[model samples]
Target: MRVVIALDSFKGSIGAAAACAALAQGWLAERPADEVLLRPMADGGEGTLDAVAAALPEARRMPVTVTGPAGRPVEASWLLLPDGTGVVELASTSGIELLAGELRPWDASTRGFGEAIAAALDGGARRLVLGIGSSASTDGGVGVLSALGLRFFGADGAPIPDGGRGLPEIVRTDAGSLRLPPSGGVTVLTDVRNPLLGPTGAAAVYGPQKGVRDVARAEAGLARVAEEAPQIDPSTPGAGAAGGTGFALLAWGARLVPGADEVAALVGLDASIAEASLVITGEGSFDPQSSAGKVPGFVREAAERAGIPAAIVAGRITGDADVSGFAAALSLSELAGSPAASLADPTRWLRAAGARLAAYRTQDE
Candidate 1:
């Protein structure tokens, strides 16, 4: 049987590619001569660089010194595509994963994200594709602006401290000293469809995930920023991603596109799925969010068009999941010998799950 193992990273446990490898290993053990293809996927959030790099060998990793989510010094990497296009993932610098439990969104900043972009520009990149998601801040990208030489002055004309809490104090924005590569273009890749402000805005929908407890206060602060800032559409798809980093990039002339679509096209995933008899795709969890431009849903749709059976294997599955488009949906937790205990050792569970899946191929009647 020709099987394609396309899966997303298991968040805190293993990367997408590693999961695929584990699955492939089990399948190979069951069917030694079976043709298996492994393709790792991401939602334009974390692990995006690794996914694209795996597909495009010509892409080079460029390291840059930038601030972490908490303003600490760190080294982050961005991809330099062969065609002078740079692929930078904001999660590398401003991701929530980098922050300890004590830090909050009110104090985090996207300044490091901007620094990475500048570094990419300095490296002779003419176009930049910024994957924005899993951000630790809700600063409306003001921190990024500050890094790019745009001064965010308070009512007293003094520069405010970095973060979303400081957004309410901004009285003016100076962009005269901002520097940009002579011939560079910027595009923002995101998975969210929330707006920059209002109930479904970045702060309202994502602030709590970044450690904010007072949603009302955070929403009010963000609303003020929206009122004071220059005109920028926040309602556009993906604009609210990365804590409004998409809106900020849009303000700076970055084209926003669906994260999965961009990555799929770049990796030629459609063609690969077309050639497979069975396409298996999944993520850490399955929910309504998976339907919102995520990889598994996209792969399922593509597989359906090609008359290929698509199956999903997730760590856990919830909600009224629409499996009509897929051949089957399997939750690793359900098949795990010890579901509760397996959460701590996902690698074992994933391998066990893979073996269980392979067993299905052995049953004749």
Candidate 2:
């Protein structure tokens, strides 16, 4: 039997590629004769670039140095596909992880992300695939827009600083030197659906995660951007992604699409599932939200559509998650005896989880 193992990153613990490899190793250990295929997956998040690179061997990495979330230089790379499509993941450029656990809610900027995009455009990429997830700032994407040649000025007609702290002082924007979108236009990939402002908006919903103690102040910053950019619809779904980076991309004429479904198509996941007798997909935490535009849920649905049995192996399966869709559900936390143990050595537990799933298949047969 052919088994396919595809998983998203286990958040900060392990990346998708490494997780897939470990799972495949354990599966083969349990059934050496069985063919196992490993396909890493991501939903417009930190592991997106790895997923694309793994699926498309023709994708080339174009490395560049850019400003990090903490305003320091960091090495980042974008993927350039053979079809002239540039793939940029915001997590690698301006993500919270870049701060190394030090949150810079009001100071971190997405300017590095925009710089990477600008580099891709200069490389002759005819189109773009932007993944906005795990952002570190709540600046309403002003930093990104500034990097793309859109200037923001205060009422005093002077340029404001970068990050959320400068958001409230913006009075007007000048797009005189702004870069135009590619002929094929831009496609923004995101799993989030929050708007750019208000209670459920970027600041109120995600600012705290980025270390923002003053949610009200952050909301005011985003509100100011909404007030200034009346031409761009702040209420658009996913506008809050990456701290309103989605809204900025929309202003640049990019269309937002569901990251998981689009990535599945890009990586030909359905075709893989069709050829496999069993498919396994997972992530860090399998919760109620997993069914909503996340990798594991998308994989499960795809496998069901293909009439193939699907299994799940997550770091931890939340109590509220519905596991009825999967033939078998395993958690690394259970196998490792504790969440701390599971996180300390994810590779070991993931391997054990794979073996457990293989045993389940054997018993069912």
Candidate 3:
């Protein structure tokens, strides 16, 4: 039987590729005669670039140094696929985790992400794939736009400051020096669908996580940006992603696509699953959000569509998550007897989960 194993990163623990390898190791130990395929996955968040690099053997990593979320220099890298498609991830450039638990809601910036994109363009990337999840700023993407030569000016024609605090002073935009998108254009990947402003939007919904104690101020700033650029629709789905980075990219002529679906297609997941006897998918946590544009949920749905039994292995299966769709489900946390123990050595637990699942499959067969 052919078994396909695809899993997202276990967050702060093991990455998707490592987790998949560990699981495959255990599965093969029990079912040595079975064919196993590994396909690491992500939803355009923290581990996006790693996932893509793992899936595409010919992809190259280009190093870059740019402004971090907290206005510090950060060393990061973007991916260049064999097809001349450059992949830039915001999480590695201007993500919140880079701040080391010191959130910067008001002054964080996405300038680093833009710098990485510019580097990719300079390196002759024919197309761009940007993963904008896990952003650390609410600057309405001004920092990124600025890096790409889209100037934001105040009433005196002086350049506005960087970050969310600068948004309220924007009076006009000048794209005079902006670099045009390549022939293949740009695709922005994100799982979020919230608009740029309002109760369900960027500031109101996500600001708190970034340490924005005054949501009203952030909202006003984003609103001002929208007003100045009426040509760009603030109400567009995903416009609020990465603290309005989606809005800026849209203004720069990029289209927003669902992160998981796009990554799946890039990895040819459907084709892989069609020939598989069983499919196993996983993530760090199996929660309500897992079913909403996340990798494991997408993999499971694909398996269901192909009339194949799908199993799931997660770091922890949350109480409210719906797992009825999966043919078999296992939690590393449960297998290890505690969340702490499971996380202490995720690969070990992942392997055990894989072995148990393989045993269960054998009994069913």
Distance from true location, Cα of 15 in model 2, Å: 0.5
Q: What C-alpha lDDT values do all the predictions have? A: 0.79, 0.91, 0.92
- Span of 10 residues, lowest total lDDT, candidate 3: 224-233
- TM-score of each model, paired residue for residue: 0.93, 0.98, 0.98
Error of 3 at 45 (Å): 0.6
Q: Provide C-alpha RMSD values for all models, in order.
A: 2.1, 1.1, 1.1
Which scores higher on lDDT, 1 or 2?
2
Rank ordering of all candidates by lDDT, starting from the highest: 3, 2, 1
lDDT of 2 by residue, 132-186 (tens): 9889999888888899999999889999888999888888889999999999889
Per-residue lDDT, model 3, residue 284, is 95
Runs of candidate 3 exceeding 4 Å displacement: none
Whole-model lDDT, candidate 3? 0.92
Where does the lowest 10-residue lDDT sum fall in candidate 2? 223-232
